[model samples]
Target: MDKFPIHIAFNFVFLRKKITGIRVHAIELFRALEEQKETKYIFHVITTKEGADILNEHGIRANGGIKVHIIASSFEKETDRLKLQLFSLNNTLKQNRIALLHCFDYLTPLQRPAYAKIIATIHDLIWLENPNTYSLPKRLFKKVFFSHSIRKADALIAVSKTSKESLIQHYGHGYDQKTTVIPNGLRNTFLTIKKQGNPERLIKGEYIIAVGRYLPHKNYERLIKAYAHCNTKAQLVIAGSDMDKSVDLQRLAQELGLNDKLLLLKNPTDAELISLISHASLFVMPSLTEGFGLPLLEAMSLSTPVLCSDIPVLKEVCENAALYFNPLSIEDMAAKITYALNSSPILQKLIENGHERVQAFSWENSAKQVMNLYDDLLLNY
Candidate 1:
């Protein structure tokens, strides 16, 4: 007798919004699954029209093995839109007889078919950690919807052990058996990109690089202050999308009289970002918290030394391959930056160790693990 292929569905609704780390993960994982020949599975992606367009732009829709289900819905109101999506998703799963659904953005159809199992990936609980950062309505939505989705999920994937612990700590116990720590993987493009020499227009001289969204938890203000106190003449290059916190960081730089030494590139293209990381003297992650610190891994893959905040998740992600600093203490952060830049031997070791550490993660491996989990879940049926 021949073995049957497993049919699974993936939620790609996140593509409707601006591209973020979560969206990237969904895309990369899908691509990896498509490339895997060892697994005989039929993959179905449930996405909005916009999501389909984005996938088409990336040539992902060209794969004959993957089926794309486009659900049309208006986005005028969040609640109504979710309702429409849930209805469409439930119908899609039942119509196609999909045995499993993987939600990459910590959300799922409110009403799932009895035959379909859910696996949700919780990237972070930032709003739960700091409610003040979000609006009251947003917080309420997250509290209600996220809690419902998580409870309904048959299994969960946490990007890091720290993220898994946070989930249980804030949401109560009994999640250990259901949750798996699967770190996000870097794109092969970042690993293969040739390091470009500094473009005088992009940066004046040797620069320290930082990349992330302009969010309060990112701690850009503290990083700017610490960079000012450093003895080196290297410019501080911060590349990320500008959000509500952008003005505050810009004002802080101006107030410190270091505007000339600070470079802010908002929403850089992937090629530009890779080039920047490839040539940087060091890549720093000043965020007070991170789900997995994907950028640190990206830097490591590109042979760039990393300096990140002394947070549990950062430590878990970088191991001893990265230099750490107190995110809250400007003095400590400055000292660590200076030490990293000045100590050639330590920097060399970090670069080598980072390369070795990054070998442990790859999209292909992560996809295999996910496929195995699907197999385990479907075996019961």
Candidate 2:
């Protein structure tokens, strides 16, 4: 029992709990870490009341190795943020005697106690890569804060090699040495596939499925156009959260004369998503950019064939388990989808490959990597 408490701060996602990824990553990571409790850990999670409430909504709370510290002020307000900087954040860190801190989602408080070492996860530089992601002022604000998080944190955690390269490309000043690549992972449930999935016939017949939030960079528009051009008879079903209602995918499908062919599913349950993916003719991810493609793994874990963009991050995650297409070209995407559907031998190989690929990732494995990082930081200290 080489146990000695090491305090680390985490909890950054202000999740609408939109999809499993956001909540699963934020809480499940810690849960995974806690399960690997042979190594000493006392997670001093500093989050807003709302953030704490969000965790509560998911039916989790403080456990033996997990300690929740509520920040009295709101993270969303400007004045309250300043107050967090000048008083709330510093006091919280000092009072906890936090030796190490882990910041998630590029959200970091600039102020910290002198003894506290910081580690921040660079999820994705999406705002910078994706145009029209934010207004000029908001972009400027992100630039100011994100740069600080990059420069200030003692160790940076990039979810993929692409993200690490992007960080260096933007903030190149020998920052790469301190940055470590630790990929996000799926829960254990994904690893074990149960055949009983589609209970309600929530979606009748076979469909090609895509799951992600409705973001411009996700390239849903191109996906829709590709499906319209696609020769396959299977319907195109895009399942995202209710938040995507603003994007009005229905209108795009209607314009493409795919109103009958395209189905938009809002906030499907875990069982439903698994059923949808497991039962799909193919699972497509047409994102222009991604930090890491967890959905690809989810789709794969269910023995579903995957056809996704040839982008670096997705490539890094999927390797040879899936088919690839140019996300920007509707013609290529359509051709790939149609070709994938008709190619029985290739699809069978993909399903077999998917079963093998998913075994490489798990929450427990991710936790062990993080614990190793924490142990190294302590030994060096």
- Give the number of the best model, judged by TM-score: 1
Q: Measure candidate 1: CA RMSD.
A: 2.7
lDDT of 2 by residue, 1-381 (tens): 122576776744344345545466767777687777653667777767766787776555687777888766356665465445434566777887777877666757767888888887887888789857557777787888888877788888887889999898888958879989888886555544354443344678879999987777888889998988877779999887753563567888778788789888788877778778878889999999888888988888777899999999998889899899999899999999999999999999999998888788788788888888888877744
TM-scores of the candidates in the order shown: 0.92, 0.90
The predictions' CA RMSDs to the true structure, in order, are 2.7, 3.1
| Local distance difference test, candidate 1 | 0.83
Tens digit of lDDT per residue, candidate 1, span 1-381?
A: 124566688887657555578878888887887777345668888877777888886667835578888776335566655665456688888888888899887878888778789999989988887666678998888888889888899999999899999999988888889898887998766755634433223555799999988877888889999999998889899998764447777788899998888888888877888778878999999988778878888899888899999989999888989999999999999999999999999999999999999888899899888878887888865
State the number of backbone clashes in model 2. Answer: 0
Error of 2 at 97 (Å): 0.6
